[model samples]
Target chain A: MNIHLTDQPIDVAAVLASVQDEGAGAVNTFIGTVRNQSTGRRVVRLDYEAYDAMAVHQMRRVAEQAREKWPMLCQVAIIHRKGRLEIGDVAVVVAVSTPHRADSFAACQYIIDTIKQVVPIWKKEEYEDGSVWVAAHP
Target chain B: MKLKIALFGIAKEIVGSSQLELEAPERQSVADLIAQLRAQYPALNALTSFAVAVNSEYAPEDYCLRENDEIALIPPVSGG
Candidate 1:
């Protein structure tokens, strides 16, 4: 398992490579990208921040949970990027390999969903007028 | 006891610092710490919700805190 919270661009290829396994017959991946618009507003960019130590710790727990929930999973890798990101840039990536496709897909989904809920990371959506922290308010 | 709590995301922004120090009586729960924080930083009360992490793990409201426990204020997470 590999988990990271980085200020630099996320290398999806590297994440996929880290999950490669000869015993694994299937690999599932999820890439989260910064979109051009948010909630009907035009987004210029996004600024992401994280409590690095705790974020990484929570990510590891996500991977662990996936492993426990899916025994067939061979490996898991998650990378989340921080700092300013333009539209279309990758913000996060989750890759999972397993002996079969079903387990890979399930584990990958779980990792991302859990990360969204528990990871100590935040993103500020920058619009032409101003900015707002995503999910900071109802 | 004086405990230092790490702040993240909007919590850091609202407090205007990355970390804060607060005074807590012995065997204080996470709830007490949050109450103190909300009193000092009223802006925290307006957030959707937040969690308290003790020693890098999300702790229950009743979890007792200790000195140098590395507590963190986890504002609503938005990561993927």
Candidate 2:
């Protein structure tokens, strides 16, 4: 249960280390980074906002669901950055540890995927001429 | 009854505020709240989609609303 929503830059190393275990044979991680472009627009940066308490709670729910599916999971950690972020900045990190490599990969993927869909977090892309909230409109 | 809803991301921008206070009928469901909001803020219809969260969980349309429940409008999430 290492879910977090931080305004500061994400500490990927610390997150990975938090899930380390002596008995775990595999550790898997997923890092999401801001891109410089979207569609045809040149993105300068992105502004992320979250429903603070709910976001953290939803993230924890994702971890719990993953653990229930993969009981062998030894540990899980998820961190998402809020506020303005420049291109190439790390936006989110998900790390997990399990006794076997297959379960580690499966659990890690499930956590990130579920968080994307269920977490109450959003990112707005700032372009040279204008800005738009990502996934907000058709 | 009156209910206050927390808005985030695009919902905030459309409403021009992070928090919204609205009048709701008693025994209102999540779907009823959304319908009323859409009537008040037609701009919300432009959004691709959204979900209503009650007490930090993704609530269904039929989910009943309580007076003091923590409610939030969750626009399509893009967080990685």
For TM-score, the strongest prediction is 2
Q: Candidate 1: which stretches are off by over 4 Å? A: none
Per-model lDDT: 0.90, 0.92
For residues A1-138, could you state the per-residue lDDT of candidate 2 as single tens digits? 788999999989999999999989999999999999999899999999988898898899899999899989999999999999999999999999999999999899999989888888899999999999888999
Please provide, for model 1 over A7-55, each residue's C-alpha lDDT reduced to its tens digit, 9 standing for 90 to 100: 8888888899999999999999999999999889999999999888888
RMSD of 2: 1.0
Interface alpha-carbon RMSD, every candidate = 0.8, 0.8
Model number with the top DockQ: 2
Candidate 1 TM-score on chain B: 0.95
Worst 10 residues of 2 chain A by lDDT: A112-121
Q: Ten-residue segment with the worst summed lDDT in candidate 2 chain B?
A: B18-27
Q: How close is each model in CA RMSD to the real structure? A: 1.1, 1.0
What TM-score does each of the candidates earn?
A: 0.96, 0.97
Q: Report the CAPRI category for model 1.
A: high
